[model samples]
Target: MEIQNDSPVNPKQVTSAQERGNPADVAQSGDFNNSNSKKKKAPDTEGGTAKGTILSIKLAPATDLWTTLKNGSVKLRMEETCCGGVSPLTVTQMFQKTVDLCGDHVAIGFKQEKQWKTLTFAQYYAECRKAAKSFLKLGLERFHGVGILGFNSPEWLIANVGAIMAGGLAVGIYATNSPEACKYVALHCEANILVVENANQLKKILEVQNQLPHLKAIIQYKFALEVRQPNIYMWKAFMKIGEKIPESKLDEIIDSQVANQCCTLIYTSGTTGVPKAVMLSQDNLTWTANTAGKMVDIKPAAREKVVSFLPMSHIAAQMMDIWIPMKFGAATYFAEPDALKGSLVNTLREVRPTAFLGVPRVWEKIEEKMKETSAGSSALKRKIAIWAKDIGLKAGYNNMYGNTHVPCGFALANSLVFKKVRVLLGLDHCTKYFTGAAPITKDTLEFFLSLRIPIFELYGMSESTGPHTVSQKDFFRMTSCGKTMDGCKTKIDKPDELGSGEICFWGRNIFMGYLNMGEQTREAIDKAGWLHSGDLGKFDEDDFLYITGRIKELIITAGGENIAPVPIEDSVKSKLPIISNAMLIGDKRKFLSMLLTLKCYMDDETGAPLDALAPTSVVFCHKNECPATFVSEVLRKHDPAFYKAIQDGIDAVNSKATSNAQKIQKWVILEKDFSIIGGELGPTMKLRRGVVLKMYKDIIESFYVD
Candidate 1:
């Protein structure tokens, strides 16, 4: 299966990679409320008068693959049935019902001043109401998108739900977004009020505030020492303003809300152009929460728990960390933004969460850690680990279709190896572990599965309200992205000779449209109301979806052979642990070539290198950015042995190629990987192929010329 991204992970500057979607890694915040600003007409979306111009960067345009169908097959659709009969529950309504069902239940926990504070479902609902009143007092009106800028915090959730309660649309700005990006989103959405995470985030908006005429007020949740500006308010002060308003008005406002109205605007990770705000209604989120919650079995009786480590701004995080838990009143623990780089694994161990939602990198890191641990063990234990893992791999493959009826020796293998590994990874109780936002290698999935961890790969987009298809436990497929989620409709738009086509969806979960952008909206959602996902995929006879890369990204070689590069790149990285990023370049070329980068696992807590490949881990120190110095550091560790190992890995992957056209015939190791700030990766950690091609033109030419 093929997978890719829009620019999200900003590799160097922000921990969260642009176009990688949201990794929720490193964070750097500063506001831009520029004092002097020109006024300009706001975009078509509802709001105050947005002022100033925005520098919009768009990825290469996408075309519908329906035009490429040879057979002109009717779009085949599938929808699963689940979520016992019930009406839609808006997020606000869900909050109310959850409070009623279990007012005393611990709804959420967040660390503050070195202590974790717990809030009941009732307290959370009340807090949201108080925040809603505060937003109303600030003159925020219906559909006036309110911006919440920060890392994942209790305050972020409060502001988001509060804005919706106050009859405004909440726009979540990625914590890694620049002042310019923050300004563009704030203005484009015409945010009347923006709740900043802390002083740093506030400072980012403040530096560019003059340019946003529509912005009426700024609220800082974590910063309390400073005096408030005329339009700025602190957390305590802001809540107090809400107290002045009678409680009856808040109830009335909540009761008056409808599900059809747009509640949130999730902006697409803009790799090439301006991030289009995908308008999702109350129904979209509610239905998604219900269906997804049911499919994943997140219920009160299930004893569910989650580590909210992903970006709250992302739909995946919103669904898993927020909506799903709200259904059963399960608890969510926020991973402190500052501690995420160092404390995530430790936190997971302590939490021992029942659900672990991660991107591919998180799982890969876990796998790498397990391997390191095994490698350091005694010879006999290492042999046992290897034997058990091999046994599990065979059993895992058999269990891909259904539960395994393994030999009695399997239990011994689990006792000797698998169970202990699961405990060390802090997933002993995890039943709903899944990887999204990026494509996880089949090898990674199989390894975890063999370890007795059921790791399902899901498929969906923000346009489809997070996930539309997920690998199921009852009817699993190793490579397929499960089946169409219950209550969602999925179809393949057109078929090639092999039945590959663009994946499309039509259901309550599909987004309403892109806010005020009719043409783009029409392009995305056709007359039949199908949400056309530019991602290409196919459905097996049993109806599981298999993604096959972006239509725009498909490389047609000089020999006129179409090759999907994701699988080949994934194979290379899977076999070579040292390689961090593998970008294949063969568009219109005679043969496939690649650029590789090494991983840098820094011990963030102690300022030491953690990755074995890092010379700074225990060797010499070199922090300068000179290419020669970087190259030396990379080549220093990648000696003849490393070259042979890399070559061996390449040779193995090339052997799997159906034909020579699809194989990576040549490759060059690079000192650095594509970073978001470098304009080489999307927020989702997807390589900006177009940008990468241009930046490394000389290196690419050298590949063929040499």
Candidate 2:
């Protein structure tokens, strides 16, 4: 693969569907030269030789966007014409192929009235078309956004595909986003229609509707509307409104779309600052979905099953739930809205999915639950379980380190404990288990490995269209993200003596620049066309990528030591079983200090952290003979036992530190745990360091007081 700087073809000249011929004919045309730009090597089209044809792409119209981009538009440049084995099909063509191949196969499944209801590929396509027509009838303008604020449901999927089908940008707003955040995204894309999940989401839209001049209508997909107003329609009514729209009109718009034009806008989590809208083109979605699906070995025609419960606003969930399933003809089951609050395991058992991807936090929660359950088991059962886990760990380490020999009693352990544990967790049928979005601690990874479950790690960002590097079963490593998928290239921008540097990506999956943020886009994709990932990583001898730390998260102490906080924080949490979160402080200070939050109970309905201690925390307290049952109780009475136990854990962590600069000199426990509601975590549960610094400014400042 090769990328270079060059002048672009005129957007006005390439806007028409007739001028921009289908990319499928690239092998035949052999027009590899892109206008007057520098000639670069193009990827081989699927089933073709190592040569590709030129694809003229028209940039998206600048509507309600900020940009001083080249030619006053976001740069929709393709460094390579096609990627390895990628067909470069548009979203419409790709979905059409799947429908043609598996028209009668189930594509989506949802629970209704205690029974699983499914939609076939043909039926799903029809629903998307119906929704597209409705969007057209509601006066959706070309390139304008259609914001969908909801959980992962059939309606959400339909609206997502429908907007793109009708030549509009599909913008997903995080379900947990505040009304103000929602307004920022909706207005940024100049949304013409907002499809919300229920009355609660509708109320939020309604609260800000008066301020949105571009919003023409709002559709509520679930529950009865408590307030009625003009231009507000229910799901069934919204579907009917587009009946008068001609099918030909929608078809014309769909046909006009090219693989390089923007179709979706994924907003960042704003952990650093204001969220940037990531412009993903048709090629980005289709190529990434197909390539990544194959990397994980997704079976076709409903052979593969997945539970969709993660936030769709994030690229990971959207790609896994909607895009990948569509590409491979896999069946997707929508988990309930409260799936994360302890109901996901029940759904997993019923569906018996073949593939599952959970963030680090979700996996941690499951690990905690399993440990709590094990602690409550009968003495004999606990003993047997421990024995099995010991055998499991030995076998797991052997396999991970490339030893073919299975440990003694492995078969017996699997049957007696591992199999039962998998069945109880509804992961018995799961062959591919994945964890991503945030760095998972080695402790959590090893715990799952002890159960004969190896959770692979995937590494990528929204700009890379997800799954830049994926750890497959055969290409597994303990803490490293596996090598890049076929056709993608990875590079360490500038290496230190230890070979750590910014991880850069080059592939068809690279997005079409950040929407309306040309300066930021230029910063992200350098002159060489490599998309610079701000993450710090280094490749091992076998080329596996190990994420060391994030460039922005590195803390430079006053003593001139550059310390990575994640590893140290993970170490602290591993030593202290009761600690929920540990943040390393002392950037530009004498030594490190820590702010911690204890494991506490949370309100399942609202996802609010409660004052009471969680079951796992209580178990820790019982084992240590500390009688506190609530976080407030510990704070109200600084019990020496609890403090001593925490101090011992910190001391253990510090003893393992490389130097004095890295050791935690002082520490304080926060009143509450970090959470999305508390403005400390992102939608995907990634820690918002910027938000945390501001929210606890006084506490952090006091740590530096001499």
Candidate 3:
């Protein structure tokens, strides 16, 4: 009732302010505790000693008390009409509900020794509790961070939920993050315990362990320890460390937790600047999970399945792979670590996930692969594919346009081509296909539409806790991000003639704030509590939201014309199928120019873009009589024929431009494509405009030289 820390730890020492002081001094303070005037009983649990009994725990009501952790309080709208009737349950309580309802359901599956190993909901919950106790034993301070660095695995989920359960922030670090980047997040979050996946991640922490005085322990959840370090524990050893810690102690921390308290920290990808620690509360996760899951048609008690491969550090992946599944009692299968490199499709085929989410690049890759495969077909096969694709596109458009009647020959097309293709891609069971975290091109959407696979587009930022607007089969349109979820409101602030303006969000799912950054928080969430998203958007008459551009990415020409780069870039790529990426380079310049990269093959193992052109690009070159194999060949030769072909494509794109200001005046084909490994794209495949500008500064200036 009187929730106070009985452990030998001080709550005052764990202030959310970036800890730069000595931990020893902070450790010598008073007891870690928080309580209101009124007392409450301990959480009620429902589970007998009998095996297979459904287990559930119900926590006491959240007291009118706030922790002293800096930027740790929730700012959720408590209105019953907001946030889909905003559930007043902590993440633990939410997971417990799933356990009670679907305890015997397969909760997690992982590939090992070429077979799938499964875990039930009850087993998953037990593992999380064990992990929570381990984190506590490892000295995870209250409100402090437990930085999790790894590929998406069952252990990763356990570590994340376990940290929150143990009253600490679960901070997910991108696997691609450099050691310095990892250090920045770890130090910024004041991580007391680092849960790393393997030696590679451990090495990153070890490089800066000395600088992190507050980091008390490092637990490697995978691979054997290569070094005998003092505070470094193996996964098995770490789990056993908390055996002496009583269940009552861990339960007390869980029972004291409120729905509106900071429990998760998602660091921004830092595309433009140092990644800000976006503070997400318990309600942010629980509410968004429940609301968005329902919006996407993930029915409760349904045997929904998803393959987890995208970086869990990102909110999109976190929600799809972790929280949403927990909310609906869905099963999650962990794709191999090399999923992005090429193994994802295999995993998709094996799991046959009911729902699949991919970044724009991921979808584009799939489209390219399909095209490449189609190009290799014999005359007869190619003819049938073309016939089926035509019908598929018609049917897809019919559905999008609300024409309930199926297009003629649609059933035949589905049986002959669409069904076969879906089976090959292991997407036959997929009810929802999603693309987000960046703008997906109309070209990619229609390409999939031609295959009877309409990839739904999701729109949101880390601040919205994952989804604000979601496109589903029921409410979908080409290039439209769809409408907001129930109870979540969107407003267009300072609209222009066409109603395009900075989009703002208001709902319970809105994050608490950026950790330790009051000014930034104020800038993001304004006086009316609306989170002012920097992206520009407008809603249609039907209320479908279409993202126009990002305010920051808008190029102000020297003549004072504001140009959005995305539309121009997408148009140019559509015109030139060989062009993989295009960046409009006319900000503050007299005329618009572009930096283009040829569609090229990428190293299957490393995900590094290769110099050789992709099959589609090769086909383009052959058809155009340009005849180029590698990007280097075209760049080195300055192949007049290829350049002229590209120029012709640009001219075609320019003809559709609304104004000369939006037209591409000149352009250059880069030797390589933009990639995460090349540092031009973030983990979610969102282009890092600032990084690209700096990397190609001289090239950009070349187009403008007098």
Q: What is the TM-score of each candidate against the true structure?
A: 0.83, 0.90, 0.91
Tell me the lDDT of model 1 at 73: 13
Q: Model 3, stretches more than 4 Å misplaced? A: 1-71
Could you report the Cα RMSD, in angstroms, for every candidate shown? 13.1, 6.9, 8.6
lDDT, residue 303, model 2: 70
lDDT of 1 by residue, 494-563 (tens): 6687878788775557776676676787788765556788888887777778888877788999999988
For candidate 3, the lDDT comes to 0.83
| Residue-wise C-alpha lDDT for candidate 3, range 368-408, written one tens digit per residue | 88889988989998999989888888888989988878767
Clashing pairs in 2: none
| TM-score order of candidates, top first | 3, 2, 1
- Rate residue 33 of model 3 by lDDT: 18
- The regions of model 2 sitting more than 4 angstroms off are 1-85
lDDT of 2 by residue, 1-706 (tens): 2222122221111111234443223212322212223343444433223466553332244332123321233223332322443334679887997887788888999998889999999999999999999999999998899999989999999999999999899999999888998899988899999999999899889888988999999999998988888999999999998988889988899877766568899999877668899888787898789878877777674378899999999999999999999988888999998888789999999999989999999999999999888888899999998899999988888888788777788899999999999999899999899989999999999899999999899999999898899986777899998878766667776778898888877666787777778788889977556678899998887778899999889999998899999999999999998999999997888889999999988789877799999888877776776788999988888878778888999999999998988899999999999987788988888899989989999999998888
